[model samples]
Target: MAQEQAGRVLRSVKWRADLTAGVLATWPADPRKRTSQEWEQVRTAIPGGEGLPSSVIKGRTRQAVTFLNANGRLPVDVFELEGAPRVPRMLLLAACDRQQATIERGDTDPGRVMLRLQLPTRVDPHAYGDWTWVACPISLPPMVPVSAVLHLPTLRVTGRQVRADVAYTHTVPKAKRTGHTVAVGVDWGLNTLLSAGALRLQADGRITALGAGGQFRAAGVLAKQHRLRRLSERLHAKADHYQRLTAGDQQHDLAGKHAVLSDEIQHVSARRANLNDALAWAAARWAVDQAIAAAATVIYVEDLGSMEAKGMGRSLNTRLSQQVRGKIVDRMRHLAAEVGVAVVTVPCTRPERGRVHFPVRRCEPTTSDRPHL
Candidate 1:
């Protein structure tokens, strides 16, 4: 009676998104391979389009859907969507990979679909062993399936899936000045990416800029990547011709082309990886170095987990794109803490009410005017 009472009192959307991946594990292969139009039909025609959980069911290991008569082998996962489990609905998504095609816009109706996948995989990007966590089977709840609409303006229907992983992350401010302290104000701007002050906090508790000119190192790296691509194409063409001669009368031009393409792909991939590493390292080093110079224990940083933050999207700034900042900030916090420094992220905005604006905390906090960070 006690267990039933508790379950009845608390009704949740299953906010923990890991639910989708858990449910799809037992579902069979694509019963009816769906086209774009067919997928669209299912969405609009299906009951409770944006009110059900999206679930993903991957195999215990990898397996290809060889059953489909297509050019390339595709992986299949059975999924379920349910707003209320009492009358849950199931959908089978066949060709939902990166490369998908639709004839007419209306024919292919479903939007960007995000299926909850249950894989025995998680990532630990930081080399430091602090805050490393694994999602054991028991740790995460069941999985669900949900699709997000793409074409409609002002309509970001995130399917019927709930974000269970959503939660507030911040450190309570506890900064006891051990010696002379400096507060560095970092301003993230569009034209000028990041503005760092040489002397963050002045003797009279005023924030001042250090360098005269703005740093434009990121632009130089972008130019190098473009130049490398051009050079790589020329090299690949020359290499392909030479490689083709190695095969005689039965000379396989396809084999030569494949080898050249594979090498070029690796080169481009490695270059991009290096660029991202450089940016992450630069941000991490800057924050740590500023804290050390301030003669203070802890650093107050901006938390971008809130919804309304502008540059957090993928298009604007490569460094600020995706959820990389969250991981990077976590790594920096642990690194700072290890050296007796407190790293606290001040709340930027209230996400639930649709405000992700962070109140800018600067070098001189003990002042009347709000310092433009």
Candidate 2:
């Protein structure tokens, strides 16, 4: 009896593997005719697929063909059973409506839902005896419109565990503006991270400061700069050492050492980049929050399209390049939109002949107007 039960388990595993392969192989030439006779021909061609239900074959074929049509290729590699390939957990489509699966409230606790799945009895008739039901406990979100269900594998140390993911859809309401029209002028600076002035434009061509002078300092900016400088010096020394070894005829494993040093430098550079991104995000969030608190309806920032890091010292140029000014602007814009605040970019144009008026007022005097630090 034990030997017979072991044989039944083996057959059930093979059945699932074959089913996955058969579904992938049946990618239709025309996805529009998914339920047509073409799928039946493809299913019969695949071994062990003849025993599968028509509903199962049709659902798998539709999904595979739709993916191929949308992407112009398969999303994943073609399924294969040879070489003991991993069989992904299968999703039994049209479960509740087709009576292949049933969900009910738990008798002991009404809040918990119990799921029962019907296994394929055609593969092995006596595998699960008369009642072929596999029970699973699940919890669902309140009032969520569940459209589809997905079967996923669970991390198990001993016994088997099955997980189900329910896909749902939700909608978000649009945002509407409130309060009076207020504007904030934002300026990106090298010394201070961001300088913002919250003000209101008067009808008599004047600006009134509501709440001005909010500046955010760049966190970890100097630390990242110091770390990068150290890494650069170390990399330079390693390169010189590698060059000296290569110049001589003496055999040395300088190539491996050079590669290792290069990898370390790259890792340090990546960490610096990650730190810069975090700092930029935090600074932008704080700036937007300050603007929102002042009831600013619009934010005006300089469009740095004509700006370049040229003519500056190498160290200063490198710092400016890594500053990611564009990313800061984008982050601020995204955050501002969430609160119904509009972000506008004005060109950084010079005052030409008879063109002295500007849209946004500068909080501080220009660098040419002030003495060097």
Candidate 3:
């Protein structure tokens, strides 16, 4: 039932985005800087625009405009979505009420703490009253603090499950920018996902390493990532070849094979994304745990956003480009924020320079500590 309702919302969002794209294609000026109200007025130009919620329409218009800004045009009509569409928060609230039901058995019992959400059955993003209320038991590996406040959740359908991503807010001590005696320096590497160690800022103006730093090695996971990447490349090559052979002729003999290949490519891409997400969380958790154990006040990470992979061989360059450094850094910041541990990204020098650009002066080699998988 949840899956069916989710499908309806997904279709609605896609339809609205496509409609907005059609309008923007003929637009003389750039549509990226338009305000929400300006975009809202465009609904009249689209047929059957009264069915969708204003919020959903606004959200999709922003997305369409972003795509246009990035790629200079809309995607091809045959483009398949990489993942499930996100249901706007307003629609979630309109479909259900009293979502903040507390557990009767108190906070200690995890089983009793469940999130009650209503999925709309009438396939209307704006209309209410035809909701299918479901009481989904909440479970997390980590315990939720009692003082935290729960906010509305965004729902998405993945495979056969309806995943609700819930977020909470709590107060934590603010991280300090200066007056630090001990800190951790995190460096990015190709083989070693991260190399982190603790350093002490001495009173006499000299810096010393506390101990041999540890490395986060995901050799097994990286191997699987590369394997999937190679498979994806092969699938894409074959799919492109099939497309060329068909020449946009849907009735061509190779059209069926091309469609199958496209579906397979999407499946493989989703698997790779899920793997990267899990790996990022694991790496971030390990980095935070290291800082906590070392009692470091701040974590200084290397900013390699502009780092180029051209110097290396073709294979090595491809592997480097596929690294999930951005995701890892984002997760690190999110986890560190909860504990008031500051994560700072410093400028990084080219790898050929034979030295990393550390935020602190004169550094020692990373620790010889055991690597964390």
**Maximum-lDDT candidate:** 3
| Candidate 2 Cα errors over 4 Å, as ranges | 1-180, 203-205, 233-252, 349-373
| Model 1 steric clash total | 28
Sort all candidates by TM-score, best to worst.
3, 2, 1
Tens-place lDDT digits, model 2, residues 1-373 = 2344445557866665566566666656665455556667667766755554554555555566666667786645333222344434445332234355666665676545666766655765665564466777777555332322223212123226544554322332222333334677777777687878787767775777875468887646755666686777788788778867767433666776766777777777767777767776887788778777887766777776546564789877766655667777777765665565666677644556632122643222111111110
Tell me the tens digit of each residue's lDDT in model 3 across 309-346.
55689999899989888788878887777677788877
On the 0 to 100 scale, the lDDT of residue 135 in model 1 is 27
lDDT of 1 by residue, 127-209 (tens): 43333322211111122111212211111123364222211122323443444344443434444444444344456756554
How well does each candidate superpose onto the true structure, as a TM-score? Answer: 0.36, 0.46, 0.67
From the highest lDDT down, the ranking of the candidates is 3, 2, 1
Clashing residue pairs in candidate 3 (N, C-alpha, C atoms within 3 angstroms): 212-367, 212-368, 213-367
Please state every model's RMSD to the true fold in angstroms. 21.9, 19.9, 11.2
